[model samples]
Target: MSRVLKPNANNLETGTTTVGMVARDAVVLATDRRVTAGYYIAHRRGRKIWRIDDHVAATMSGGVADVQKILEALTLQAMDYKIRTGLPVPVKTLANYASVAMFSSRPYIFIAHMILGGVTEQEGPVLYTIDWYGSVTEERRFASTGSGSPTAFGVLEDGYRDGMSLEDAIKLGIRAVRAAMMHDPASGEGVDVITITPKEGFKEIDTSKYL
Candidate 1:
């Protein structure tokens, strides 16, 4: 049997900010909550961070509907892979699946960008950026997406360091997203952050206080 996931109609046109970083022991993912529709602000508490599995999560940008569609597809693929193999899907495999999906949909006008981060038994902490056209790049340190990425990259480049503690990585992720929110008109409202570690898997941090 096959399952099909429907996209959210209302979020077809939206703007956002998303960032992901790989630290020594964990991977950090963050994004702004604001959803923009052209010059208007549509939703303030929109969710851009998606949890794919216990150790994998994704941050999204571009059309929310397309983002949701891609996430749904990835989630289904992960579940099927686990059921068939009795093992969790690796971070790279998931990235490759997403890349194929994006590339197949490119000619149809489906557009979305994603930053996927996770911890695996073999790869430890890893991060990958999947562009709208299905091009995937494994980012050794960090990656950012959406309209505010330029501003977010500034903070990430300045603050990120090798082998930093997970706490410090979370703080840096927050700082990067916060800087983008402050400067990017399309990115604002609040920040959502998640950390993936071998011990605790994927967990979301309460970042309301940071805004």
Candidate 2:
């Protein structure tokens, strides 16, 4: 349920809200399902969250095509790494890889902002934010991106707590995205949520009941 948005000069900043948080034993990612182009709602049910592997997932913001291309490359790279080394790629490693890719493509107008999350045998749950310019930050608690990020950050900074349960984190993630959607014209339609844990790996929650 996603539609492509044609970019324009005035709609260069068009984007949605995406949030990610690390909980006690898992990581949660949530996003609004909207795509916009110069104040026009191009898609009402766009997908912003993606599962990268059994225990890794990502939420994206910025040009849909650019983000999709980066994610596809990351997926292939992850598979190749796993097959060659018989080990899951570290979450930070993936973030760095994405940063390098994005940085390398900056001159070519490639833009993609992403929050990557996953659980590793050694690291437990980890989260990282990679910007379009290749800047990468290891977010210890939570991260939010896109045009609605400011509003989403307000909710996350106020509601987030240390060592919260996965359920609480999911609720907060949803709340953050919902708040952003309410305020940001570029974000709306519905919500999509995903959770990653050692036990369940990566699982998409049924956002239909709530959104």
Candidate 3:
């Protein structure tokens, strides 16, 4: 027999908002800071974004402990790849590993969606939307996940343009998450933002004004 976990209102998948956008020269990722246990606020300053390496990052929307373990494993994989190959691990490879981790859990899935983003010379600015079932889609423009995604998509629609600046991408990412926070009860408190640029690699941006 396998341990099974069913969906509910308070699960990680339905308790947050996370967004990722690919600019011409950068990739931006953002998420809300609230953690909910059903109707109760379990934590106020929850961090959904994890930096896998200097050039890569991911957003989590599931069981915190499970997600953290998956991300930590990815971090080790990245380091090991670089040590072996002498280069940063490609973005798609990281996403694929995440998918495998979720899929391998079988009946007891990881109940999470990860939006992976990074900058690499080989793939440029890359983004991936990965579901709990281990399906992966390479995002050319942008992607959002979690309970607040529907609301966030509304703000992202018609706003993204070709060759937008990194600053513009950051602004748009913040706006999307903020809009979801206003409409989704599970997503609120504050917004966190980060950008991976060709020159800067990975950097966290202050989003106080936008929030």
Instruction: Pick the TM-score winner.
Output: 3
Q: What would the TM-score be for candidate 2 when compared with the true structure?
A: 0.91
User: In model 1, what are the clashing residue pairs, if there are any?
Assistant: none
**Candidate 3 per-residue lDDT over residues 25-89, each given as its tens digit:** 78999999998776778888988899999899999887677777788989999999999999999
Tell me the TM-score of each prediction against the true structure: 0.91, 0.91, 0.93
Worst 10 residues of 1 by lDDT: 1-10
Residue 66 displacement (Å), model 3: 1.7
Q: Provide the global lDDT of candidate 2 against the true structure.
A: 0.85
lDDT of 2 by residue, 76-141 (tens): 988999999999988888888898888887466556778999999988999999876778999999
Candidate 3 structure lDDT: 0.85
Q: Rank the candidates by TM-score, best first.
A: 3, 2, 1
Q: Give me the runs in candidate 1 sitting further than 4 Å from their true place.
A: 1-14, 208-211
Residue-wise lDDT of candidate 1 within 1-211, one digit each (tens)? Answer: 0011333434332357788998988999988888877767888888889999998999978776778899999999889999999887999999999899888874564567789999989989999998767889999999998778889999999999999998898899999988988888889888889999999999989876654
Instruction: Give the better candidate number (1 or 2) by lDDT.
Output: 2
For candidate 1, the TM-score is 0.91
Winner by lDDT between candidate 3 and candidate 1: 3
